[model samples]
Target: MASETIPITVEFTGGLEMLFADQRKHSLSVPAKDERGQAVTVGWLVHYLCVEVMKDPRKEMFVLDGHVRPGILVLINDADWELEGEASYALQARDNILFVSTLHGG
Candidate 1:
């Protein structure tokens, strides 16, 4: 069952990478379905990042109200996530998902 999971690339930038072990890139394998037997989507990835991957306790800085916080942009395979169905996008094998924060702090 573990071998059946899909492998994908995840990247963070614009200071967001600082929260993820200070690494800008990550490789992950996720199950095909959720606990409810539903196909995994970008939304699932968000939750997984917080619960499983996040080393920081400031989850709200990554996700707010169950979704990606505003001012952050998500891209899939170099295309905007909104064009790919946003949170509903079904993750594919070897897909590249990037999270870039637009907020700048001095």
Candidate 2:
């Protein structure tokens, strides 16, 4: 039978870890498909992180208007998310997704 989930590594940096239970790295097995029964994409992962992983209430710091806030860089497997089709990129097993916040409070 096909696996129901896919393994992935998510890293938070540039002070973003504070929003994720103060952890820098997380090893997770996410659903292989979303509620729509489609391949899970980076966008789905983002929502998962916010709802299932993030413990802090300051969600706006990481996401805004249902999307990653500006100044946060998303890297997929060491490459820019933009190069990988941004949020539309389909998640693969063992993929590493990194979120780096470029905005820092003074």
Residue-by-residue lDDT tens digits, candidate 1, 49-103: 9899999998889999988999989999999999999999999999999999998
**1-106: candidate 2 lDDT, tens digit per residue:** 3559999999999999999988999999999988878999999999999999999999999999999999999999999999999999999999999999999774
Which residue pairs clash within candidate 2?
none
Q: What is the lDDT of residue 11 in candidate 2?
A: 100
Superposed on all Cα atoms, the candidates' RMSDs to the truth, in angstroms, are: 1.5, 1.7
How many backbone overlaps does candidate 1 show? 0
Clashes of each: 0, 0
Clashing pairs in 1: none
Residue 100's lDDT within candidate 1 is: 94
Query: Among all windows of ten consecutive residues in candidate 1, which has the lowest summed lDDT?
Result: 1-10
Candidate 2, lDDT over the whole model: 0.95
Q: Among these predicted structures, which one has the highest lDDT?
A: 2
